[model samples]
Target: MARYWDDHTVYSQPSAEELRRKAKESASTAKKKGKNYSPIMPKSRRGEICTSWWGQAWCRNLESYADYSSRLDRGKGYVRSGTVIDLQIHDGKVLAKVQGRRRSPYNVEIRIGRLSEENCQKIIDKCSTRIESLEKLVSGEFPEELKEVFTSEGGLFPTVREISFGCSCPDWALMCKHVAAVMYGIGVRFDENPFYFFSLRGIDVDRFIGVALENRVEKMLQNAECKSDRIIDEDISSLFGVI
Candidate 1:
């Protein structure tokens, strides 16, 4: 006879042994806090959007710039004309700034509440991964059924980054107008349906968020174990001092 009823929730939860194994695996390969992830940002028109002095020097070189641009354009989600100004999240508020026009310098500011960490991470991860996966499929040796969707031409990246907006400044620097336009457009999609990015990639954001939450829980368990070990070590040291 069973000692307790295993309802759906209880039965679905991972076994204690499984949970411990997952925590150990995850902690061993956990991402370091300050590791550079190379999160994609829009390239400035002069091709000067690099983060380091070496990158700027490379951008200044025509041969290097051409090669980098070609590779980036081939990659999914490479935008050209507009740049991401800021991404901010605070107590129940999310804010983003995008630049638009040359003459007027159109900018968009978005404020949204009730945005959870899981939801935010899901959006960032899904949108980025979907674009990258499609790009990889296009470049990969394997045959693909949806080759048209990942074509180097008519993709989201160049359109988002390079298209000239209402800003007719004549200066080549990626300024406010283009960024503002992209921001406004993406914001509307987000407002109409929060999972718009996932929809674009043929995924359910809710399901994705659930998986991320499980990963976070595993990380927390590992952290707790480390903390417990430290406490035990301190206690033993104090006892030895008294002896």
Candidate 2:
């Protein structure tokens, strides 16, 4: 019988230097073949890849799941060492390529089910009630209140059960290092473009904002109309001596 991946002891893990060398070699070979490659590099002084609130929230959300937390540390190392060569987010899916010990890079795909219309409308209504929250989101800052909106049950971020992932690697573990690296890379990407998080969930931020603004305007108009009608009623009552 083939030994399981978990059967290998931690002591048998490859050194950081070895991983880095393999990544470089693989990148060079890909370049020779005229393939475009973009790797993720840690920017923080402490080698932390995710600094912004959006990025941290994404990483934290993933770690909250027991199924993924075990391999996240190794994935962090893979991302920091520039092992993820390419990552793309579109239509509720994330696709990536991660270099490992092997010469060929692994392909990773993560799918997050899109929120239902009712759930999205609920979020929009809640966010529209607070103009400050929308402003902070547009400014690339996630306020505490806004964070709560996303972290809430059935909110923006998908629960573990709603997420499906696959990695083209031989590892039998459900969450492999390559998949973890791609996930961390996505967090780093969110640091640069917070809106990508919504895009990954198939939410068009611009369109959502437009709808929210329109709703606000309509409410304002209704309030104004009601005030005008009340003023006219009072004027008519006074003119007819009805008090």
Candidate 3:
């Protein structure tokens, strides 16, 4: 007898419990093999993942791009479920290992264009004029005023055109679940260290602050000189009885 399977029948999807079990099994196996894994866990009991403003801003930047909105939900789920086994950031790119339905993990790479020297200098100049902005950065806060500097055209944050990504998963979508999880993981990383965001853009925070301090000092000296000149002119006019 020849048995034929119906091609039109829909396959049953794995339940949430089954997916979690599979993820845990794979993670345990990888750990036993001495594989280093860096998983993102929700900080709050209510499942709050990103607490810092910088982190939230990073996520918001991704969401603002309508093209990525569709996959963000699934990515968030993967990140929360400990599917992103490891994520590393380098000079101009991020590398990650994401666990999926397959026994083996998927590789993901996210590339962001580095800021040019001219653009870096421009950012330094902008931040230098605002002492509060530097203070906020030091305190791990993102200044509302500096938002324009980063989100503006040709700014620190990568634009849609400047950012590109790839995943080893079989999914053909431009951004697969693995890629999205890694992206969200970056936001969590930013929460832990806001400087990571600047690093991603290849900007040196210390250098930026140093240049801004110099600018501040120069402006102060010029203002003092002008004030002294005005005082001397007033004195001379008073002595000569001139208006």
Question: Which candidate gets the maximum lDDT versus the true structure?
Answer: 2
Steric collisions counted per model: 12, 0, 0
All candidates in order of lDDT, best leading: 2, 3, 1
TM-score against truth, every candidate: 0.23, 0.82, 0.79
Of 2 and 3, the candidate ranking higher by TM-score: 2
Candidate with better lDDT, 1 vs 2: 2
lDDT of 2 by residue, 1-243 (tens): 776754764435666677778888887888999987777776862555788876888788888888677799889888887888878888899888888877778999999999889888988887777777778766766667777667888788889888889999888799998999898888888888877867888899988888877777777777776646445544777788985
lDDT, model 1, position 143: 21
- Give stretches of model 2 more than 4 Å off: 1-12, 45-48, 136-144, 226-243
- Tens-digit lDDT track of model 3 for 119-184: 887877787777788778667676778876667777777888888999997777998878988988
lDDT score for candidate 2 against the true structure? 0.81
Error of 2 at 206 (Å): 1.9
- Per-residue lDDT tens digits for candidate 1, residues 1-243, read 554655334223333344334433333333354322111243333334443332332223312234234333311121232222333323222233322222122233332223334544544343233434434423422123323222223321122333233333233344333333333334332333333433333344456555545555566677777655445545676778965
Alpha-carbon lDDT, every model: 0.34, 0.81, 0.77
